[model samples]
Target: MRSMLLRARRLLGALLLAALLAPAGAMAGPCGPYTTGNIPDCEPQQQAPVPYGILETQGWAYYCTGDHPYFWGLSSSYPGDFTWDNSCFSAIENVFPETTPNKFDATFTNWCLSAENIVVTLGCSSQPPPGFGPSCNETGGPVGDPGCPQSNISNHCSSTNPPVCFQTATETCSDGTTYSCTADQGIVWCYKCG
Candidate 1:
């Protein structure tokens, strides 16, 4: 009789475990406080048509500035239910640059691509800042006023000796002409490389 009871207990435990591991929505009901459409206002707003062109650029610039309160408010409206086209993030992907191995990443899709040895950082630091390259160039805005237009470019030289070239930062030459500079990540840019 004790053996039978032990066997029954084991079966019950196994069944309970299986049920718990199943998908949370298997029951499919109003699931207490959070119903299907009952989302809070703080969620990112579902972006319409994914702002493209300069509007997209401006949106990304705004998102980059964490100080904006609307950032979180706008994000809260995103539908938590599923991951769709993700048109909302297109601006960010387009404005910034992306790199690939043996291939040039012309369009910006995501940040920090290790294959191309490219990493974009926030604020002026040892690494290239977010808007350091054509992103800033296309926008035609001063990189920043932090004592200098902090920028750099790093890129594969495709030659011997200096297989990798980098430039920290530079200023305009005495002749009032700007020069080109390279950064540590092999990103090539112009900024009076004197």
Candidate 2:
């Protein structure tokens, strides 16, 4: 009887071990879209798209703060490469709406000058835009002020009372939830997560 009891104990330990290991697979899946925040080993995306376009290919909207020093020059000079579709130039323009609401006229209208121009514009930033510097917190120009129209928000902005900036416009999340920006002036706020 003692011998049988020992065998039973060994069987119970094996069952427990299997149970512990079995659920690891399910846990990884239930996590559903792991972020770098949770997984320390995960690497940052090798190809970080510069924020541009009405809808990022990865399904994100972008905003900008006129901080890109050479953005205007690049956009004006490099017509083929600079525009709303490029992600780097688009980063500020894409994130604008979260704070200022309805600020990106170009995005509101769903304008796409050409897919090729948009592609060229991505990953091409020699200088920062006018308002933004190295940091998002640094306030440029007047306080309580809106900077230039982001490519995404330009069209609708000119028609507003204060000559509103388009990047300032806000948008609802894909989940249909509403969230406000932390601040209005310096940083361009992105509403959704990729």
Candidate 3:
């Protein structure tokens, strides 16, 4: 009778061990049926597109004492022609002189590009802060600042399947000045200021 109890206990332990280990083994098995050589015939992994946009930094210039700077502008992205406009001004609390006397810096965070193109423009107002003139060359152009008066900027994909994405844009002012900006993996990689 004692031997029978021992056998039953051993069987129960073996069953429990198998129960605990079965799920792990199943998880380790090939995703699909194995080939004749026992190699996994798995399907190729599909890569999903990561949606993103471009962010432009504009409006960094020298400021006069007690003279707050303002940034007012419009930004747009193409392949879909989405647009955004904003106005930002410096208050006594936020405006301060930089280490270089009479110099202040500000940025324009507008527009994003998921796929194709991005266009950003600064200096929309006629009375922009001193030292903050229209950087783009705008000859014979419209009266007021026509935000980034350049042509269409393009972002090309490297591959179709699991495509590598890049975002870029060029700002050409009326004065024949140029600035280039690029984005990779949802972050601005380089922004060449005029």
**CA deviation > 4 Å runs, candidate 1:** 24-194
Candidate 3 lDDT over 1-194, as tens digits, reads: 99999999999999999987543223222221222221111222212222223454344332221111122211110010111122221111113322221222333343543232222221111122234333433233112222464444555443235544444455666776555434345543222343
lDDT score of residue 110 within candidate 3: 35
Q: Cα lDDT of all candidates, in order?
A: 0.29, 0.30, 0.32
Report the Cα RMSD per candidate: 17.5, 19.7, 25.3
Give lDDT: candidate 2, residue 92. Answer: 27
Give the TM-score comparing model 3 with the true structure, all chains together: 0.21
Clashes of 3: 11
Runs of candidate 3 with Cα error greater than 4 angstroms are: 1-152, 174-176, 189-194
